[model samples]
Target: MLDERAAGVFTIAATPFLPDGALDLESVDTMVDFYVERGATGLTILGIMGEAGKLSSEESVAVIARVTARSDVPVIVGVSAPGLAAIRALSLAAMEKGAAGVMVAPPGNLRTDDQIASYFQNVADVLGDVPWVLQDFPLVTGVQITPKVLRRIFDACPTCKMLKHEDWPGLEKISALREQEAAGARKISILCGNGGQFLLEEVRRGADGAMTGFAYPEMMRDITALAHSDPDRARDIFDAYLPLIRYESQPGYGLAVRKYILAKRGAIAHPTARKPGPALSEAAIAEIETLIARQEARLSAL
Candidate 1:
């Protein structure tokens, strides 16, 4: 099981679909191999990047089983859903299939701190003995959990093991949480997720590692390694890819960009994103190619 000591890059994986919109099971195995070869210490499937909502429950379980069977590292399954029954059922299925743990993002319509705490308390009650990660991504979940509220939930539930910290402008929150731990709060492993945008600063603020889906797992692996051992070198490496990272940070277009790049890298069979998603504009593709060229040049110089 993944614990507080878990660190390094835990890449959020993209779900591959065929041109006909069927789940590409073959591509799932290929994608797992790609992630492990690229330096992912862990892999998260069915995440926001994985297009979790678009999948049926049966497809979701199949994807989890396929990934766990092939992944060398621990696999974290995103089981976030509208109801505890659904979340509980999915998490149990994932655990049965050998998942390292499951991840939960706060459901929508949770506005107040008390409501948030209560909701997670119910989640904990349902999860019971299953270890889970608390995904505190305000940008997507629309639920802001303050450090105080988070501490309460952590205290109330011991099963919540990790924090998938993706709160924007949340550096102070990380610092504050570390301070609390120093002053005797329960220590929760914090793996940040924001497409590697604020990765360097996050590490400086005491993040364990990156859990973002930025397509380039090696960049997360190398940059965080140097951030720990050599700040100057980490910055130089981070700077080279900063431009492209920013480009790929678009809200809805990000996952499509990841799939496109993954296909080009031979990680997946196709770059077919499911419907109801924005298509990659010609201008967006041109921009990404230019950034990739610049990124390669910078890396070559380094």
Candidate 2:
């Protein structure tokens, strides 16, 4: 099970799909191997990046079973749902499939600190003893979870073991949580998201590591390893990938870019996003190619 001590890269995995919009189970195995081989100490599946919302309940469980079966590293399954029953159902299924833990995000309707704390308390109750991650991505969820509220949930629920810190300008939240821990509050792992745009700074602000998806998990793998022991070198490597990272951070179409690079790198067979997703234009593809070429040149020089 996941604990507060968890650290290092927990790559948010992409759900592979066939061109026909069907689940590609074989790609699940390959993606797992790719992440693990690239030095991801852990893997987070069915996240927003994983296209979890596009999958049916059965498909979610199937994906969970497949990944848990294939991954030797800890697998954190995103089980966020609108209701406690649904969350419980998926959390139970995930735990049964050998997942190391589950992740839950607040539903958008939450409007108060009490509501937020109560909702997570209810989530912890439903989840029983199964460890879970508190996802704090306000940009997508429209719910801003203050550090005070997070501490309330942590104090109320011993099973809530991690925070998926994705809030923009959330470095202080990390520092505040660490300060709280210093003052003797519950300590939990704080892995950052947001496509790793601020990974270097987040680590400096006391994050455990990255919990976001990118085409090249190795960049995160290497940077996190170098962040402390060789801070300047980490910055150089992070700078080399900044252009591609910035391009892939494009809202509403970032996943397509990431999937494109993943396919190009042979992690998946195709870059198809499901229905209602935008496909890359020829111009966009050319731009990505240029960014990747430049990134490679910079990395080689480094």
Candidate 3:
């Protein structure tokens, strides 16, 4: 079970790009080492945080292979393709390349509950014995895995062991799952997926851990520690970090800000994102610099 094996802070890492917009393997290695050194329990690569949609299939596979080779911790590869065939192929490839587990979104189309359940079942069938993480991001993928549908999928696929719940009313679903488990339903780990903004809240509501994309790995560790060690103290840390989280969560600047922080911390070679996406405005860049400066000063004080 993913929950039993990986019940701590997991980072969904960003993919680093070169100045010419190519995948930077060296930078990827550095980021992997940085996270593992800072206490990440596991690594989720080729995820939304990694800009999975932007990478080619080969690039995605290479990223998974490199991270898996470099890290001792579990590597969960994100399989986010829309079509069932494509997703199945990618999942199999990830498994073959030594990915510890596969994370999947519901079939990209707006699926009916039945279709959604069947989609997961098919993925589990194709994956054979490999563990799977059900990624529940309704806004981006346009499919909602209702509780009833989730029940069906879990019943149908014993290998579907975890879920990354990103639905808006996610805590309600987590509560419902807990109720089901208490009443003899099968146990499945639920990981929070809505960045770090809601991570502390999700843990309080019973999430096993998080798959957030926030820049500061140590801050995330602090959040997790507070959640487990002292709930009230965790809330205090979350509140104190709220301003930085809000700034980093902005739509157009989120990735840029994260990469900038990584660069500032000497974790990555460059803060470049793939082309077709516009560059961060000078104002946004300055804001990120200020945030980075504040973060450094705060960390130094600690």
Candidate 4:
């Protein structure tokens, strides 16, 4: 069992892209500094928020290499794809590039528990000693890793140290993992990954911390502090930030909102994402602006 204290808020970062849709290494560096400075304990690059599915294997490796070179803080590269070979290759590439761990999802649209376990075990076998975080995102991957399957994989791969529990039933999953730990069973860290909407609840339910897509680390930092110091106060802060979370969690506008906010704060050059993923509609953009305005107004009053 890994120490819970070692696990903290991990950011599933956005992969800043140039206007031409190429990887923006400079912006990646800036974002890394942005998160590290504001209290992110580690970074999980090329995850869903980073648009890993849109990036080629080589492009993903380049981005991971850039992030790994800039910081000693733990970097968990996302190795989510269809084939076992492709997943293994990506995981090994991340490990070779010096990432502390790799985050992976089961094969898309295939929800069989056995297949999911095999997917993780195969990648773990190829990874050897490298650690991994099973990304439990049922929305995108269409595969739910049940608690029984989770235990099987953890038993198979001792190096699978954590789980980015994005499943909506996240609190229930956390409870199960904790029960296992209490029974002297294989222990694993559970991170809140469904943005900040469920963060307070997850932490109260025993999550180590969060791995959300929101770019404003300050908001997450403040909530984390509140959760640690005063739970009721944390809920109050969460209530205040609920509007911003709603704006960012909007369908088709989530990443757009993240990039726009990052750009608004000058954390990135522009709020641009790759093609096929449309830009935020005018109304969506306006909603984000309104959310930011509300946040700023509250800050000024404070």
How much does each candidate deviate from the true structure in C-alpha RMSD? Answer: 0.9, 0.7, 2.0, 2.1
Model 2 per-residue lDDT tens digits across residues 121-170: 99989888999999999999999999999999999999999999999989
Write down the TM-score for model 3: 0.93
- Clash counts per candidate, in order, are 0, 0, 0, 0
Global lDDT of each candidate: 0.92, 0.93, 0.79, 0.80
For residue 2, what is the lDDT in candidate 1? 77
Candidate 4 to native Cα RMSD, angstroms: 2.1
Query: How high is the lDDT of residue 95 in model 2?
Result: 92
Instruction: Determine which window of 10 residues in candidate 1 has minimal summed lDDT.
Output: 276-285
Residues 110-191, model 1: lDDT tens digits: 9999999999999999999999999999988889999999999989999999999999989999998999999999999999
Residue lDDT tens for model 4, 1-302:
12334467788888899989888899988888888888888888888788888998789889989999986588888887766677778878888888887877776766688777877788788777767788888877778888878989988998888888888867888888888878887778888776778888887777777888776666677776677678877777777677898778876768888898888887788788998775877887787888878877776554
Give me the candidate number with maximum lDDT: 2
User: For model 2, which pairs clash?
Assistant: none
What is the lDDT ranking, best to worst? 2, 1, 4, 3
- TM-score of each model, in listed order: 0.98, 0.99, 0.93, 0.93
Clashing pairs in 4: none
